[model samples]
Target: MEQGRAQNESAELGGNGHDFRPCQSVNFTVHRVGKQGTKLQELDTPRGLACSDTSCFVVDSGNKRIKVYGRRGVMSGLFSSCQTFSVSNSYWDFPTSWSPQDVAVDSSSADGDHVVYVTDLKEKVVRKFSHSGVYCGVFSDQMLRSPSNIAVDPLNGAVIVTDRESRQVALCKPDGGLIRRFTVPGVPRGVTVSPKTHNILVTVEGVSQPAVYTPEGQAIGESQEHENDVLDHKAADLGDLCVDEEGNIIVADRRNSRILLFDPQRQFVGTLLSRKDGLRDPCGVDLLCDGVVVSDLEQHCLFYVRPGVANTSITKPSQ
Candidate 1:
């Protein structure tokens, strides 16, 4: 049993000289974490990145398919939800068009464990599926338009999708209820969620953009690059983002061909990887178990980094 632990305890002890109260509260404890592996598995679809049931998931743009990898970066299976079936031949239904840019998994599902979610970019909808590549359902709320990226609030399973051309983000319930549509100041590209927090981060191609979000869709942080004529922030065009175990942020600074690590305060810590490290046009990033999985969009290859070990490469979007 844990209670709210007061912050700034020294203020409580010497508050006689001034008006004092607990400024903040912190909770510490253990939790049942889903496992994810960091092994460098073969690569496919170096585009949409998500974690479904503690495993790394990707929508390989080039392959026109999705791939699953376990916590240790073991190849699990290929996503076959979008199948071709003639109405007169097979008993299946699919959207008129299916083009996936990003994928997500519903973390709150209890039925058909490992339920996966993906954005149908061309169809302007979000499609739902099972971990085994079965067509589960579809989310076509009126709010969705050119949906590109998908993220889910693991706590409540709220679905978040980004529409690249529209420069907006849509929030919906797992059952396909439209909650809200948010306008991102810049052209938003990739997006991510922090499991330990409800805050969502989005990458934008706008000049000086970093990430902007609020609990209720308000812009929290503006683009950090090009503050003024004085000094340019010069981080890079952020395309993908992920939070590591230590709550540190890993950003794929695309155009600059580098990846950056930032503290919780959104302050730049350092470059985690770069083109000098054999990264080329690194667009999407997902941190698996103890290693990092990176997608080089231009090269169509997947690269994994392990401590003290050489990085291994796999052909992009393997069939």
Candidate 2:
């Protein structure tokens, strides 16, 4: 059975010598106050967030829309009070009843175009749009029942989504063509693609342990490898997760009100951020070039945290 051995060859099966130990109390401070400026820029129950080199896309769940912000925290466009889109096309009509649950950015195109994939939990559909918020099209799959979380493969542009109602995970192309689907034991919550290995990391709804699988849906390790000390599978309230450049998994432990870390081999590393560091029920997390941005439900704001760095504040609006 040829499982794309060459692709898997470069992927390290273990941590790349990164010491999986707890760091000393690092300084954490409020880097950005709210999403942007003004009351409208403020976030209300923001759930899904993803970042790129220049901007951040946040799932403004309460507002039933997605908000885009620059690296310096300025509102981009489309959803702002001053800007409006040409809704002449029926597909571009206002999404008053849509409830966006998650968001991800795909930049693996030959022409270097970035596409944003957003999941509408209320309508059970995944929608695609340009980075500037132009409506593209729906995922249009019958298997996408109650799509919860979504992720994009940076190397191939494959979108992975968990269908809670179907109790399975579906791998689709950027245009929503079904490549394959596989069932898991428990309800899947958060799903992410490992940056170094390209493996799919999935967090179960009621299980603290997360499972890993190859792109072809082959389980990566023993059952014990999925269990960890930092993850609260019992609470099963884990939110969205992202892989760092160092191959570490940063998961939003919503039930514990902190973020947990794990090595590439699915080993428990340590607590990366928590309430002690000023996080309250953090939902979505994404790594920026300079720092990390977390969506906190209790605070109703995005907390910017930098590890092992002196505390500083950036109050200037993005230019």
Candidate 3:
């Protein structure tokens, strides 16, 4: 594809007063992980994904464990819930049955250690873990019914969680203290914070676009429209999402098997990847320095893609 920026265009503003500019077309090189697995590379129904500067974490939902991988896609470590008991006066070990839904990494500790937060669907709480997989504690509240996705605030280190059953979002302190809670328009699927604006971006089911909110639980803006002519769908089954430093939003359209990009002003830029890119049920997404990481539930793997500036292009889904 030809590589260049489009002609300069006039800036526009959205309902939230965000300055919008023309979006540049880009091409992405996709890489697959866990397709040909080692013992540690095998995954099943992986859901949530989060990354720090040095490592990426995957909530291996089917395996009932959290897998850690280095930037180069090598498995560094893993941890799971375990229980010990005494049977016939002998010690017996068994795995704990817990449903881990999503994960978020907090890299704001003063000691330079990253904290991992995982939402437990079965327990209805958010469990905390150290960078090395040690259980720290958990964040629990009567208001949280089904915590599905989570994110951390870049400005204040607050943990944000979305509950689909409750149809609400909660902002909490680093230690899991509830700061505030507010209801959303629909079932919330994903939650994220823009590193540049600190604005919370959430994907709600039945809503055609991701909703934007202020840190104080005030609704701000939403994408005016979606570029969905290729899919011929009126609404997108949005899953997880993340924002880059430039404030661009990367969203996982699970039902369409595509990843989408939106400018800071919540304007649909273009499709980043689709089913042609070997994505099957892209459920979770996180922004990396080089590109973006996506978790495919149906494929039971992850995709690391390095996107670059190129002539705008969109691929139609295979028949």
Candidate 4:
């Protein structure tokens, strides 16, 4: 997940035109073949961002690689040598696909080791791996249909996923056996489950409301309107949901060009950032030690956001 400076610039929103609310001082730099120091993609459209030892693991969707970087967006040698996962076939014995839409890390597989799990959009599968980015394997059986998200349930090593074509969420084992299935409102795009709350949060596409439910699929809240009934959300397209230390939900409101902050109570705290907030079609959103991470699906980059910083300006959050 990536975050940009939440200061400056202008982006149109719902009924009321607004800019981004300054969250904190945040920035990012691209580290690629010719993009050292500062060379960044025109849009840096990354699909997912994972955290490891204060560094960010970003997946470049348009391209076919995953990268690791420091908090300042500096290049770290974590996923530089990582290969692409395919959809129709396998490469280097790894999975293949058209897009790497989402990823999850199995932090508790073996003594808190970081294992990466990526959801190949076109492949409709999730590939698991160890922290070293090894070709562990894929979790596919004949049940998935265009899966958009993946997460490893620490409870029983169940791999949870949400499918777009099926408009439902399915649970599976590493071997790809059907664990359970549940129906959702619409085409669920982004999904997140918290061990503490044992609840899964889903961001539905074409729907302004995000649904929060218990592990058993009981309703907790909906993202239709704010508690005060103010800010009417218009097609949130919540690409990512991150639960913080306090279980607060940091939603990457993709279409809105801003990140929405919600407490575990499902109350809208306020706007985190916007196009002016250094956000550009932010897709993957997750939390790390001291801040939030966002993946720019349009720029192929990972951005960082410190929730407690003084000022975050995104007039040009790019490298």
| Candidate with the greatest lDDT versus the true structure | 3
Q: What is the Cα-based lDDT of residue 248 in candidate 2?
A: 68
lDDT (Cα, tens digit) per residue for candidate 2, span 186-228: 7788888887789898887756656788999888874353353
Per candidate, the number of residue pairs that clash is 8, 2, 0, 31
Off by over 4 Å in 2: 1-22, 30-32, 35-39, 72-95, 223-236, 308-319
Question: Residues 85-188, candidate 1, lDDT per residue (tens digit)?
Answer: 21122324332345667777765666747667877777677877776667667786467767887788777888888887788888888878988888887778
Mark the 10 consecutive residues where model 1 has the least summed lDDT. Answer: 9-18
Give the residue spans of candidate 3 off by over 4 A. 1-27, 36-38, 72-94, 222-234, 307-319
Model 4: per-residue Cα lDDT over 31-143, one tens digit each: 12212222232223577666653455566665555554444432222233333333223333233344777777666556766667777766666776566556677766368
What is the lDDT for 161 in model 2? Answer: 94
- Stretches of candidate 4 exceeding 4 Å from the true structure: 1-44, 70-98, 221-229, 232-235, 307-319
Which of candidates 3 and 4 is the stronger one according to lDDT? 3
Ranked candidates (lDDT, high to low): 3, 2, 4, 1
